[model samples]
Target: MPAIVHFEVRIDPERRDEAAKYLAETLAATRAWPGNQGIEALVDDADPCHILVVETWATTQDHDDYAAWRTTPEGKSSLGEILAAPPSKQVYSETLPLGL
Candidate 1:
């Protein structure tokens, strides 16, 4: 089954643009990942400082691989500064019936 991952990020209001820039660059890389299906980022219209990143993958294993890769020295070095705080993440498996 496909996997859906969501991450909620709370950033400093002053750094909202910086955070968006960082995500734009990072998500570009994710979009090219082997198992990545889709990626989206949304900013809360009412609360500009809050951001949500949603990702879809071919399978759970794909997300696991991505997580491992993210811990690598190269990845950490690139992603270290953008985050204002640790992201809250969740995983979901999609279920759908045919012929909606």
Candidate 2:
């Protein structure tokens, strides 16, 4: 089953809108990456500088591979430039809820 990745980041207050625009441009490569199902970025309603990225991949391993590549210079994303600090990430498995 596919895994869901929640990536949270806070952009530099100075970059603001520019950071959002930059992310839109940069995420194209991620959307096209192998095993990527889809990607969506959501800005916090209370804090425009904060962003939450929801991503779906064929499997946890797929996301892991992509994450490892992101650490390398070749596949590194320019996000660090606009980020105020390091991002947070967590992977989750889909689950069914029992009826009450």
lDDT (10s digit) by residue, model 2, range 1-100: 8999999999999988688677887788779889999999998999999999999999999998988988888887887889999999999977788886
Task: Score candidate 2 by TM-score against the native.
Answer: 0.90
State model 1's lDDT. 0.80
| lDDT of model 1, residue 11 | 79
Q: Which ten residues in a row have the lowest lDDT in candidate 1?
A: 74-83
* Model 2 C-alpha lDDT versus the unseen true structure: 0.88
Compared with the true structure, all predictions reach lDDT values of 0.80, 0.88
Q: All candidates' TM-scores?
A: 0.84, 0.90
Could you give candidate 1's per-residue lDDT for residues 17-69 as a string of tens digits? 68767777778878888899999988888987788889999999998898788
- RMSD, one per candidate, in order: 2.5, 1.5
Q: C-alpha displacement of 74 in model 2, angstroms? A: 0.9
